[model samples]
Target: MNPSLRNALTRLAFMLVAAAAALPAAANIDIQHWVAPNGARVYFVESRVLPILDVQVDFDAGAARDPAGKSGVASMTQSLLDTGAGGLDEDTLAERFTDLGAQLGGVADNDRAGLSLRTLSSARERDGSLALLRTLLTQPEFPAAVLDREKARAISGLREADTKPDAIGSKRFARALYGDHPYGRTPTIESVTAISRDDLVAHYRTHYVASRAVVSIVGDVTREQAEAIAVQLTGDLPQGEPLAPIPAVTLPQASTENIAHPANQSHIFVGQPALQRGDLDFFPLQVGNYILGGGGFVSRLTKEVREKRGYAYSVYSYFNPQRQLGAFQIGLQTERSQAAAALKVVDETLAAFMAKGPTEDELRAAKRNLVDGFSLRLDSNRKLLDSLAVIGFYGLPLDWLKKFPERAEAVTAAQVKDAFQRRLSADNIVRVIVAGD
Candidate 1:
């Protein structure tokens, strides 16, 4: 399905690795929560460290929520939210933000869609930014012409991706793992082609409602101002109930899928359903994965597949914990001729690690790396704002950021082995290979 934690770890890995290689500070994140008048949940962090403000409005609408026959509706709705809203065209909205020195942007991922604003905390700039954001939220007009243009552009991009072996591998890997589930939904020429403006309007009406929203605020603002900002952002949206929960992920039975491609290198994906966000195994899996394949050049997989044997230049794995069970995935790009041998080594390496877990020294290094890098994740208010949005959307523990370090440190090697053995098995691992000789 969606490799949420994979994306998360890759981004965090960059920030975490570049931080000072010392012990992480004891984090003290004061997160506050409330409900706005319009039923939007609000998560606020009063930060006065800088004279700036960051606000994000998130809804439970994302790619996974797309209607059965319309895979791109949610993404299109989010992309068009600011194109023409409250009587302002896209260009006019851009100008308004520029004049206020505010950055207006958004993202639509597998589990959530959100818009964010960053601006100076001065009343003139902050108020203007919030006002503009409110307009985008409460009055998105999915202009038919704009929708048509974007659809054409998206089709072009999708078609281009269809030709690339790497793209095909990733998309098919999801299908191999989560067959018939919403998590595996990908934009096809047909699926995107079928999406009408009416589809966007309906998705916006149903999933962009106040009750499904999470208003996350960070940086220079009082609690009172934060509350008012949250209300202004969400108070006038359509009222709708929370969405029904997505179904649990069912792991694909073990099988190998080899597709012919002209590329000289094979793009391979090996994984299975493993863990969910906030699972008790989160720490063990997080720690153990670093020792297994997540620690960049120092990882076991990289050393075995790249450094030791020169079979590939890059190889890694991670646990992608989503709302339901996510995936533990190992990926590599190797020459077409070495595809079979590389895969054999990968299979043996995984089995050995699963059987024996990481050594004591490996476990210690994993904890140190994870703990030292934890602070980097919280180094900026923008990062913290993003974290708050994820927490609110997933209904995770409010103290998740605070507990990340200690929990990771507490994980024993046995715990890691137990967790991995219970969740992953050779019996269920799905393999996807593109471009084999």
Candidate 2:
């Protein structure tokens, strides 16, 4: 086959895999898990539905792991992984993937950083992509010129964000809730400017080790092939010492900060640290939140704050469960003049929900909505790979996805109320309003 035509065909195959419909919920997702010889935790699900595979390797290296006074190191390190690795420059590395019909991406969040790949499962394409991925994981060049360029770009982006009212409100709200915890630390221009190449190399060496790696794989691969893939990917990783657990999140004293911004709308955030990832309270809190504010226009927050009073166009609440205690946040934007009234309604609604919990009808609806829609979460190989990564990284039960509906249905109104009351305290809640009257 002509080289160009062959490459185009391979790319089309990958696109077809991505566009394919979600595997049926009834399709057995038998997950196989093991630890590689070099200590990488691996979880895999095999599906013959497509001739493509998705792989994600997660590490305990995220923004929260940034060294003091260097808040953007982890993120910068992750981004620089593919820029130059194994003697390949940025453009060559990217073009190599293009020729193989594979996609490589990286993610950095509060608690984890990692690379993800999607490639055609044919032996040539799969082998070539995995080889590149292995090089990225083990031998990133962290080229000096690239580091200088990215640092400047990051600083520019941070400066731009500083001027936005929503961004100001978010940063203040994080600090108010998390106090001095790393979770509260946002990357400022100064912090990114201070991140030298040595900082990136050191952060990568400390955190990107075999022991901290979680390799999740999904799609058209056999168990034996998957095992070999895991070994090939992580076998060369540095055998660094175990990472120290992140510090616990200290709940903050209840306070409200009103920051002046020359914007027409007020951005508001409410609530406090409430749930950790994989907590027993996840279902109860999630179901209850749907009634409180997560159910879109049908939620009580929307009814009172947006529909009835027209104080805001949209309002919502959610419990973001991270490795440590994450925030239970209520967010909305409204006309500056109505910020106070909107906030008042949000607070009252939240207090009432915490006091009485979701109504029976609301609970049933929430469960139904979650349960009926659960299949959507698993419909794609990429989605399955994501869930597998969470399960592997967080040490959640292997059957977590399979049991979601059962657990969600089991949550009672009393459980929801008790969970909320125990987790959220009015005294420790933080509220930040930007551009409010």
Q: Which candidate has the highest lDDT of all? A: 2
Against the unseen true structure, what C-alpha lDDT does each candidate score? 0.88, 0.90
Q: Rate residue 202 of model 2 by lDDT.
A: 93
- lDDT per residue for candidate 2 within 1-437, as digits (tens), equals 45974866866677667766647472367888999888889999988877788999999999999999989999999999999999999999999898887889877999999999999898998999999999999999999999999999998888899999988889989899987799999888889989999999999999999988999999889999999999899899887897788999888999999999989999999989999998999999999999899999889999999889999889999999999999999999999998998999999999998898888999999999988988888877888888889999999998888888899989999999999999998998889999998
Clashes of 2: 1
Candidate 1 lDDT trough over 10 residues, lowest sum: 17-26
lDDT of 1 by residue, 1-437 (tens): 13753454455456445643432233768889988888899998887766678899998888999999889888999999989999999999998887777788887988889799998788987898999999999998989999999999999999999999999999999999999898888889899999998999888889988988999998889999999998899889888966789898877899999999999999999999888887888889999999999999888999999998999999999998888888789999999999999999999999999999999999999999999988888777778888888888888888888888889999999999998899899999999999987
Model 1, TM vs. native: 0.93
* Model 1 clashing residue pairs (backbone): none
Q: Pick the candidate with the highest TM-score.
A: 2
Where is model 2 more than 4 Å wrong at Cα? 1-22
Q: Backbone clashes per model, in order?
A: 0, 1
lDDT of 1 at 289: 95
